[model samples]
Target: MINTILPKPFLFLLLILICAETRAVPVPPAAVAYTADIIIYGGTSAAVTAAVRAAKDGKQVIIVSPDRHLGGLSSGGLGFTDTGNKEVIGGLSREFYHRVYMHYQQQDAWMWQKKEEYGNKGQGTPAMDGKERTMWIFEPHVAEQIMEDFIKENKITVYRKEWLNRKNGVVMKKGRILSIRTMSGKIYTGKMFIDATYEGDLMAAARVSYHIGREASAVYGEEWNGIQTGVFQHGHHFKKEVDPYKIPGNPASGLLADISAEKPGINGSGDNKLQAYCFRMCLTNHPDNRIAFPKPDGYDPLNYELLARVFQSGWNELFDKFDDIPNRKTDTNNHGPFSTDYIGMNYDYPEASYAQRKKMIKAHEDYQKGLYYFMITDPRVPANLQNRLKTWGLSKDEFKDNGNWPHQLYIREARRMVSDYVMTENEVLGKKEVPKPIGMGSYSLDSHNTQRYVTDKGFVQNEGDIGVKAPVPYSIGYGAIVPKKSECKNLLVPVCLSSSHIAYGSARMEPVFMILGESAAAAAVLAIDDQVAVQDVSYEKLEQVLLKENQKLRFGK
Candidate 1:
């Protein structure tokens, strides 16, 4: 017999190495193919609208969503519905809000608070319209219900928790995707594809060119495309002067943990930094349905010492952004200098690995939770403010799985496709005409702070927050949605369509995304019918379909 005896230590070592190697190897499961006329990737509000509209057009559609939840931010947590010119939102987008209005009409919809008790304020318009029967703002769960209704009503197939296999995920032939396999080894084959993800994961994986972070103003020939350090247009920026050093008034003591000591880039220059991200927490003052903010693990009071200093400077505008929605809850957003937007922390998230992204998300959660906890419990915060804040907590009914935190992080902007036509600030601000209008957008060019750093005088300051109003409701071009014909022929990118950073801020609104989603789906249907690449779909035909579908393409047309 062959000698098989080995030292006990050698045998144990061999077993250990084998286990490590086995764990390290990525064993992609055998793929199960699901073919359809159209394949939409993402669980965003845009994804739902795409699937819905495609089905309405008598096309077999499937949504292979990375998220278990369907409606992205609209259902995930952002229920406030950022509507600049609500009139521009038409078609299935408006239909969705109409459904929300219809749902609230039912007596049982008012579970947490009575309908009459709700406020009249919403986007500066009447929140209720018993006549029109359409509600604009709503609770998180209500929005999720609306998205689910669309899927159920249309019988659209959705694969939840199906992540795209980033590496070797997309199989293409002659600049067209043959099929895409998910992380779980499920293959999705479709005639046409729509990338509705916030991150544009599918778009990037298909070998299409995309730009992340800010582009210099020179590239887009616009004023707001790049960095703006001195311009502080929003209230969330630092208004009080506080030293950024660990020791008061001493640079030698070193900067605070999160504060970058390096100089923020020159104004109007391009940089890889992205805007800060945070959860649009659905907090409520309702006693019965409130969970007191728990002290999260790794809570550090020193991290927010600057906020305490701001409070000491007699700043008491904490509740300025506690915009009230229906029920007893508030769509609490980043307001003061040191509010929910975890500044200068998520620059790597646009291209981070999934595991790294999870860590980043968890870090943000812990930071925000700790902020709330400190606000309510710490003595440094004024007693009056403490008492005022104590009444607010995460809604007990929202986000039941993860301690009431929102399921989606506010991924404001990510990888934008370098497509045929890049929408710039000039087009968004109505200085230039959109050649082929598909959808309309009127939201201001709004971008959250990208970084918080020490100024020349060693005082803390925020950079890259802007809110420039538009001259009129501007049109979105079809070229913006379709990738460059040479890059990828069949893919339509709606969420992260071709645009400069500033213009994307206006176009990134949920309603606008849904509108673009439907338009993209309609384009896909047309492409499939005509047997053409997405770029070759005739604008005239696309217009007829969009208008017939009640897509509001322009301001007065």
Candidate 2:
């Protein structure tokens, strides 16, 4: 019919146009309904552990992760374990360390260094414990491999690099999450959901109540809740007076970079400032496994002027926090007044959009990389410390895909859920008993500096570096992980559990995250079996199941 309506040349053009138009129109793929019994949202250690526990309980589980790798900080380079009291770390968390021990028991695991060369030194404990058969410290790749093994052994499905569509991604009906959609338009439906992310992205999208930044000391009756001006429990504070101005003692010349001009808020008063964050650098001195720190784009020497002044003041403890792990590597952390922590730079990270968060993360990475470059090459830095640092380089085998840099930026604190019962200093210091104990935390009330500001005496000092030892290991309540019955019924949050800022500092350790992840999975499964909201899961039955699964609910138990 078309041939009959036009000449030969016109008809040929018409056919070509039709073909081109057809090719231009893209046929969308059929939508897949990704359904699971339990959908855990995150790629942290908690996400892996939660998936494993749910799969072990005979429920189809899935991990919708934004990360390409598993094991958040545990595999991101925090190889030097921060276990406070290893006695209380049981269940899957302890099992993870035991697996690390088993791997190291093989002679092949010792690749860079010999077994005898790597001594058994750890955080106030033996790195390789023969009694419990647990290894506390390990390389990043080892931890990642163990986590991958967990997923493979349990046959848990993980959708990696799937970013949650925070805006209108969640479908909630009658206060219960029905499904969550990722940015790639993949829909995931589940009977129960677990928010195991460090950022608490899914929990926030689901409209669960949460707190960001420090609450006042009066909010939770916690002494360490708010802005700490004069308190310096750790050695990260400024020990000597450093000039705050660009020019020595000249206020009009403008304050140096990274030092805020605002008044360090009233002591014990609340403000919306987050603690500083840094990458837990994994460094090695071995010639075979070393990649010299590259100068990041936009490197500047003046950015680290404050540290140069700190050096001139005779404060030279640069190598203090380079805590060693196996294979002659170090889990380098922020130390001294001016170290790896990008203070006053991460205030907007908790609620930032994905695009904005990417910029913030890039800024932090650049700052740290530039700092490392400065320490090694800058003439202003003390010659002795500079030479000592020149020997260390990023571990070649660790985070290889990321150019030997740690893949995860250590998010020390983020969106903490505001559930029915908030864990506070009262519970941590044993001043109050936890209700329906689910797990235990023994680490001290630790928080990194939030701001670097000038003191009233017109000298520079760091603010909010706290470290208060707990009286003893204390129980973590079930209510800390579940949302209020009215807020959300089917979801559970473990990593960003309900806790005050100071209390979360202690509970934010990787082992505790794994412990809570397992417990949250148990509760989610029981809630599904009972057909009740997570808030209504009976603590009696939950406790019995936890104990049966070898979870330590108390220190002595």
Strongest candidate by lDDT: 2
How do the residues 1-557 of candidate 1 rate in per-residue lDDT, one tens digit apiece?
69899999999999999999999999865668899999999999999999999999999999999998889889877877788877788999989889889888889988888988888577756666567666788888889988999999999999999999888989999999989999888999999999999999999999899998899989979998799988988777777777788898888998876888778988899998888899999999999998999999989888788888888988898888788887788788898788899988898887888888899989999999988998997789998888999999999999888778899999999899998799999999888889889999999999999988889877998888999999789999999999999989999999999999999989999999999999999999999999999999999999999999899998898
Instruction: Please tell me which predicted candidate would have the highest TM-score against the true structure.
Output: 2
Note the Cα lDDT for every prediction shown: 0.90, 0.93
| Candidates in order: C-alpha RMSD to true structure | 4.1, 3.0
lDDT of 2 by residue, 1-557 (tens): 35446789998999999999999999987656799999999999999989998999999999999999999999998989989999999889999999999999999998889999887888879999999999999999999999999999998999999999999999999999999999998999999999999999999999999999999999988888899888989988888778899998999999999899999989999888999999999999998999898899899889989988988899889999888788889999999989999998999998999999999999999999999999999898899989989999989888889988899999999999998899999999999988999999999999999999998888999999999999899999999999988989999999999999999999999999999999999999999999999999999999998999899998797
Give per-residue lDDT, candidate 1, residue 153.
96
Residue-level error in angstroms, candidate 1, position 19: 20
Candidate 1 deviation (Cα RMSD): 4.1
Once fitted onto the true fold, the runs of candidate 2 whose alpha carbons sit more than 4 angstroms away are 1-28
Model 1's alpha-carbon lDDT is: 0.90
Candidate 2 to truth, TM: 0.96
Q: What is the TM-score of each candidate against the true structure?
A: 0.95, 0.96
